[model samples]
Target chain A: MTDGQETIKSSIWFEEAEADNPYAAASCYCSGYDVYGDLLGKVSWVQYLYLLFKLDLPDPQHARLLETLAVALANPGIRDHSVRAAMNAGVAGSTKASALMAAVAVGAGNLGGGREVYLCLDLWHHLGSDMEKWQHAISQPSQDERIDVWLPMEHFPGFDPNGVTCPRPVVQTLALLADIGSYQPLIWLRDHRSELEAATGYPLSMAGVAAAAFHALGFSSEQAEMLYLLLRLPGAAAHALEQEQHGWRQYPFFGTALKPMADADYQSLMKTTEAK
Target chain B: MMESTRNSLAYFDNHWPTNKGAWFPGEAVRYREMSLFDDFRDKSWMDLLIYGIRGTMPQPEVSRLMEQIWIICTSYPDPRLWNNRVAALAGTTRSTGALALGVATAVSEASIYGRRPDIIGCEFLISTCDQVAAGGELDVIVMEYLKKHRSIPGFGRPIISRDERIEPLLAVARELELDRGDHLALVKRIEDVLDRKRMRMKANISSYCAALLADLGFSPREFYNTVLLSFTGGIMPCYLDAVEKPEGVFFPLSCSKIQYQGAGIRRLENVKK
Candidate 1:
């Protein structure tokens, strides 16, 4: 089997095996239990139960654990919290939760963050214009068609961390990662940048970040895409949850309320924070 | 001697008659008149307090209430309830400044309905991106115009009597019995302002649509996001239509020719010693 397919299959198998044989109770025996059964059809609940039993883990508990892990892994803030919790849990001998936390931390920090960083470096390596050359070109005062206007800017050519441009944190992180010689995610970055820019009318910083993160994590382009999709799931969920929790419906006074200006005191407070 | 009529006409045209004629006898006498005008300057604070109290209570409370509603809607396991909640949120009323809140609620609704293990695979991603980009651009442009012109654009237009889009959504809210009365009051106030201005500017549909989403329980940030999401559906078809137009280019420019009346001197003449 291909490395990716093997990885996916093995991961699935491992999860099932772990669930069925929690505490290694049934390591020796247990067959006809597959987590990913019926390649083209619906997977049955019986199969799920069998897979859980084979793993030797309590069925409902394992399912709950997986769901929690999934949620934690998807959100960066939650993942960060999970990492701390995992470390504590490991110390406290909470093996199952610790193991889950470790897996999530690795997935989020090393795999996800690393790939994003690599992608940014790759783009910079390939498409970055030399500062001196850019300055010389700009100074020549010729209306050259080839001159890229953004080339001379202090930051990298296309990544804007602030939401004013794309507002995706991944892109900014990738740019920073590339500066430090992470992996090369630029191949995908260069290819997709123009398309993303045209599509969004904003720079493709997030995509670059995603590519870098994927590359660092040793994900192929296709795998990287899958990982990105996976990572974004929790964020979307969290946003939804927040919305639900807040019970915020549509603004009743929309179009009637004058736009608010930040109070001077608030502005001063912001300045104080910035200074600090 | 009598002057030629043509010559007199030419003189009259050229001179355009200066103020050489005599004024009427009473023209120089200036008359001063005084009229009583009520100045609300003393009661301004009271007026403001009353206005503020009336306007402030419903929206903030409604927005907070909607946030809870959004949670319940999304968290409910029933798909039918989820869809209904989403529709309800989309059809709710919101505070005037609750754009961000409204978008958050709508996006959450959309997210709940379109939930999968992965968000990148969601069909709404591109739509979300497009909407955000377009809305962001519009906001920037509007802000820039406000800076330049000292007024907000797209908020009030004279030609539109009432925002047509708001009524249906409000009707839905009434049907759903989610009407907080504050939204209605706010709408009326907006109308009053428009009438007073007499400039014909009326609230655009986006404002009410955004407000409705907000009233359903979206955060202000999410309200903006929802606007972007909603516009994405509209933008894709519009962009496609633009691309598929009969003309090869989406946009064409017409060049204008100007006639120059000048001396026919081809070269500069230099005086030498």
Candidate 2:
């Protein structure tokens, strides 16, 4: 065994103390700031989220950028896979937490998902503002051999592999975000949006925009991934709860085409299988 | 109302072209080009589930083996299990049936335990068999696999090094006369090689099931999807039991349970005021 390495998990942002009663917290400080005494009700939630994750306060412009991104991510709609997974559980009368878990499971993927944002930020880190690098990288994402890392980029992280054209909402979002702040990544993206789309033949999706926005916010790839998952939960939660209210009868259901084998067919198949 | 085909502009399109049937609410519905209501109305859910995965129903004996395997294995209702804890917690908190079981089953796709290890183990055995067929030494191949993957999935569980489920699973397989597959024998030999190497890795329940299922001609992906509901039986009871209890009373660890081992009590400055 190795010495000097601490075994247990510990908090980074918070230094919490118990009240006279063990069940209650007496003093809670976040990143040297007194959370209850000085910070409560003073900063907006967007600013607080930035502080909690980044361990530093955000300027107004950065906060606005983050807030816009948060609102953009708040709901992916019922058609989205993550929200649909939650809705599937919710309609069947699953718990709110269960719906969220389902959402997280489906959303934590590489294609138009939170994990895509993670890999997108990573790609951004490697291939900053170079078009040639972007072209080469998109075609062949750097082979990440780490077992723990997600499967190699499933259609260039941010772009929608299944999309026909750059979505109207995605274009408007890029324009809005570009107008709201001076994040270099977003500026570059806005300027070369058409060129990139033309090169890849894949439309820019919300996930791609989110990856850029989060990268502009100075969040790490891992942190951006987590934020993507968290931000998208609001939509999953709302749709799941709504679907629960609507019940399974109204919710979309795809029936599988079942092909039952006759006894003779089964016997022949078994004989063939046994021969193998 | 917005729609488009894959990488092409179109008003409306279906992504899944091979989707053969659908439910049309009031009118007649088709499944596998057959009427859903008219035919196969009284068939067991097992038929539907198995057919949905493989696109064809297996022999009755295979179905019976699967049914018994499902019964004997993974029926643990103990709430202490990590997956079952989710179910039990949901139950205690009065969550709906779908939510508790759904989340619990979702979590059962744990890398170290449950469905993932089962799929991973099956893949490993298949790959290992291929390597052996090409004349690679057993121990050398096993060593190489371990070096890349770190730990062998479906072997040596985290808690209790000795698995309690393996014996019962074997007993059922023996009764069904499905115990003598080549993959099963190979896996046991691999366990022996591991033991000889001074590694405490034993073939756990997932490893055993993986070998059996591999012999049954299930692909790794198919096996992965098939075991999604494996832990539902165990999780359901935990959820149901917890639901019967009072609100928010499951475990309820106090603030003192937390050991605040971080930089404590700092001043409030530089808050962007």
Predicted model with the maximum DockQ: 2
| Backbone N/Cα/C clashes per model | 82, 5
**Tens digits of per-residue lDDT for model 2 on B30-85?**
45434566656765666666767777766666676676667767878888788999
Instruction: List TM-scores for all candidates, in order.
Output: 0.25, 0.80
- Candidate 1, position A194, lDDT: 49
Residue pairs in candidate 2 whose N, alpha carbon or C atoms collide under 3 angstroms: A94-B99, A95-B99, B91-B242, B91-B243, B92-B242
> Could you tell me the lDDT of residue B103 within candidate 2?
77
Which residue window of length 10 is worst by lDDT in model 2 chain B? Answer: B9-18
The alpha-carbon RMSD over the true interface for every model, in angstroms, is 39.6, 8.6
lDDT of 1 by residue, A73-147 (tens): 365553343333333434344334233434334433322333343344454444343434323432442231211
DockQ, candidate no. 1: 0.01
